[model samples]
Target: MERGDFTDLPGLGKPLEDLGPAEQGHDPDWWLKRLVEREKITVLPPALQLRRDDAALDDHLDRLGGEAEVRRELTEFNDRVRRVLYSTHGGPPVTTPPRDVEEEVRRWRARREERRARRTAALAAREPEAPPPSRRGRWWPFGRTGAAGPSDG
Candidate 1:
């Protein structure tokens, strides 16, 4: 009943690699959870997803280029949270509160200023560049007049 269809497959004869001691007793879906995490899959329900996003919101805001972009991101996050809260579709309860736009903007500004200060301090710590040489008093290898060649009188 068999052809060479599976002969060329990778890890064909090698034993499976163990992740670690399995927590199968404590959690029946431990393998599934590990697979999800290993694959970097995002399959959380809306409420839980919002909570995760809320946790990393500051980091998200830091990457934005401008205050308007930050405001837009905050507004979008809040809208998603509010939508999850109002929906009857069940998952974990939505406990993540909507962020205040003005307060976040203030915090974002403060963080930007702190980063700028740190960068300025780092630059100041480096040695200053040397000034360019002057043109009027140019140096010559032989003499100011000309090269000491045999043709000179």
Candidate 2:
């Protein structure tokens, strides 16, 4: 896989000094440090200069932890939704059903309850595992580091 140019990243030329206490998990400075330290890119000058001082870094860590929590919640929600979808309608959903509104409603409610119960049981059987921490972040730094580019200092 070929890495591309850093300038081509989603946000470029902008320094990472804007991180605030509340923006924790989304710390641009932390993200930059991660890339420099983890990705082993030699040419690009480490963006350490942009590191937020004072209380911002602490908030950033808190934000990162919250991100982990959000991910867990999202995964559980997705699993339950998928289970409900698959269980309630084993086959492709009927586009047009009989006009018996009351009967259809009754059947649907029953199926939904059954599917939800099964989902609860299945989810309880196992817990979601978080993956290893990755240095990569919103910034997509790429392409030919240590190439004596202009940013190479």
| Per-model root-mean-square deviation over C-alphas | 8.6, 30.9
lDDT of 2 by residue, 1-153 (tens): 166655477667665554555536566477777778789965521122112221243233333334445345434434544454445534444232112334434444565567679999999888787887887543337755555544522
- Each candidate structure's TM-score, on Cα atoms with residue i matched to residue i, is 0.62, 0.23
Q: Which regions of candidate 2 are displaced past 4 Å?
A: 1-101, 136-138, 143-153
lDDT of 1 by residue, 1-153 (tens): 198788789998775554444453355576898888799987889988998899999998999999999999999999999999999998889999999999999999999999999999999998999999775533554645755655423
Number of the top-ranking candidate, with TM-score as the measure: 1
Model 1 residue pairs with clashes: none
Candidate 1 regions off by >4 Å? 1-39, 131-153
Q: Candidate 2: TM-score?
A: 0.23
Shift in Å, residue 71, candidate 2: 37
